[model samples]
Target: MAELESPRVMSKLISFLSSLLQRVAESNDLNRRLQPQKISVFHGLTRPTISIENYLDRILKYANCSPSCFIVSYIYLDRFTQRQPALPINSFNVHRLLITSVMVAAKFMDDMYYNNAYYAKVGGISTAEMNFLEVDFLFGLGFHLNVTPTTFHTYCSYLQREMLMQPPTINSAESSLCMGKSSKLHLCFNDDESSHQQQQQQQLAV
Candidate 1:
């Protein structure tokens, strides 16, 4: 787990997310271009005006959550989208979703976490709205927040692979590959009956 929280891992995650947001932004542009005749009415909602990189940086600075919290938040985002297909991660709702997921993951995975009011301040929303988003996001995820270590590492490995598949711009390709290899080795090392039993005990305790 410590390996997942390392600076290298965090940097790669940030880069991967930046790339993802860029792709989303580009896709939105393409859609708008292709559908120029039709008024793009996204459930009567406007896309978020803030830049994704800036919003992510704000969360990284003020959320004060562990790196693992962000990783777990990514996992929750995946689950949320899978469970709630109508609420896809696009420009319109990605910012709110990101903030809500991070807040929920911090609360579930960390012993110490800020309340909704504090998260609202960090996320630039009102406390009441934050509360609403929290409740809605929890239901969207079906309240499933228990992430086993194996699942955690598996997500990390996927992110690493994604980073590797992208073109190397900042010399992250080698590091991402190394991280993927390391996570696979770690998974193998932890694949034992004792570790499985321990995880079950931890789940029950949760």
Candidate 2:
């Protein structure tokens, strides 16, 4: 249990700080490469055709959730959609698929706990339907739920150390308490999925 929780609860918090700063410094330097020449079947996923962005943005705006979160949630939807090209498409069907994907991601990423009932209540569905969707999504992803990465973990770790390193006159402990509340708020921001195969390949290659 100690080994399991050690890295989960505490990772020398110092080491995580440097790695995070590095990622931040490098984030802007990274470029995307979906060569225009290549034919991606889902290239239809691009905006000029479906305008998925505007469609999702409208729904998420109603929910008071960021368009970015819905966008990332669609990334998860595509993880399954890309593999199976024939999934049915409908108004509420799209929302159910996308929302269920995000809930799975929230469960993995949020420091706070989430349950299917919470999704059902907000989604105005029975808990049984949420459960079925959850199961369907898992099976679709080959029983994978550990795929999403939480950017909050690094941000929280950095905030903790930043508060710690401040001059003593600032009341370091008090500063930490104040920052803790703010960090909790940012954790609500849905983070982007980094690499899908990285987690799977790393484990399997070992």
Candidate 3:
């Protein structure tokens, strides 16, 4: 794995990821107003007061995982959404989703990481809930946790395009969070798929 990113780069990465997730959650929330979706264990009875940016920043500040873990976590999220189409990410569930995905990513990709109890405290949930979330998320994703080098590069390129399209501005009034036009994330992880096909899917509707 690559060395950890510098603080500045990591901060920028966090800001970019936070903005992207916030946009996804907000979009899903708007959609849910029209058609209610099935709620799962990931959903909270009420949305947490903490802003998405602050919550993600807190995770990065304390988790101490490699930068690659962030990318991997996002991959896990996309996979989960694909497998569980009824559970599109929304404001009520995104926070728990973020914490669980990051924790699982750290466990898979990092040599050393804090246990579930510590992550539970950081995420403002009980240790038992955190453990349950980890298991449910893995099953939701069918335990397909290994990210090949090609798949990793594909996601990195997609994020690079996103950063270029929308510069890393956290919450500027002038900034708009218009994501890519497609409604589906075209991340083809099948080994049989060609790189060119995956590159085309890099538009990344999410």
Candidate 4:
């Protein structure tokens, strides 16, 4: 009985983690797909994907960023998505938006932001490169950076709830996973992009 239960328990945990990561990737892809695609950056492609998760992933990896950064980035994307009346933006344009959103998010959310980010060091090509990407992203979303999920009413409710709960990891990861996806939030648009990236690589141009 113990042996059987162990496999079942592990199976459930793996499923939960996979589901969480899927939620994150979905959010990320949604934001990317909403970009305007009528640009050169999206053409000349095969085995195409919705966004440059790799480019965004690279920039994020090179930066001394935080979870707050992901929050802010997702917020920015949500805001942009909400305001934009258009869709099907190319991957390049979306990538630019995400990078700029991260920069803008850092400025808005943190006291001191990282300046003088060298492209070589940060995995971006250059400041000009950054600007170019930001502009395109901004253009696609129509510069809608005002609205976001972080400020949503339900999010506020969850924060209040999270504060009341015992601190995270006090319970097993499975316990945390079982609580719920809506409030627990194992994934979101900007977060969890790295999870299951291997499957993503197989399916995408990356």
Q: Which candidate number would show the highest TM-score if scored against the true structure?
A: 3
RMSD of each: 8.9, 16.6, 8.7, 14.3
Model with the higher lDDT, candidate 1 or 4: 1
In order of appearance, the predictions have TM-scores of 0.70, 0.39, 0.81, 0.43
Residue pairs in steric clash, candidate 2? none
Model 1 per-residue lDDT at 30: 49
The residue ranges of model 1 lying beyond 4 angstroms of the native Cα positions read: 1-4, 25-45, 167-206
Clashes of 3: 0
Q: Write the per-residue lDDT of candidate 4 for residues 1-206, one digit (tens) a residue.
A: 12212434323322332333334434434555444323333223342253354555565555445435544465555545444434322233444454666765554455545653443235344666665555655675565444344343343344334444533331221211123445343222332222211111111111
- Candidate 1 residues 101-141, lDDT tens each? 89888887766667788888877778888888888888887
Tens-place lDDT digits, model 2, residues 1-206: 12213433333332332232223212211212211122222222322322333433333333333223332443455456444434422222444565576666655434443467766655545778888888877777564444344543444444455535652121211111122344421123244546443211111110
TM-score of 2: 0.39
Q: Which scores higher on lDDT, 1 or 3?
A: 3
Q: Which pairs clash inside model 1?
A: none
Q: What are the per-model numbers of colliding residue pairs?
A: 0, 0, 0, 6
> Which tens-of-lDDT digit does each residue in 1-206 have in candidate 3?
23227777667677888887787777677777666588888999999999998999999887777788898898888788778777878899999999999988888777667788888888999989998999999999998888778778877777776666764332321112222343243454554323221111111111
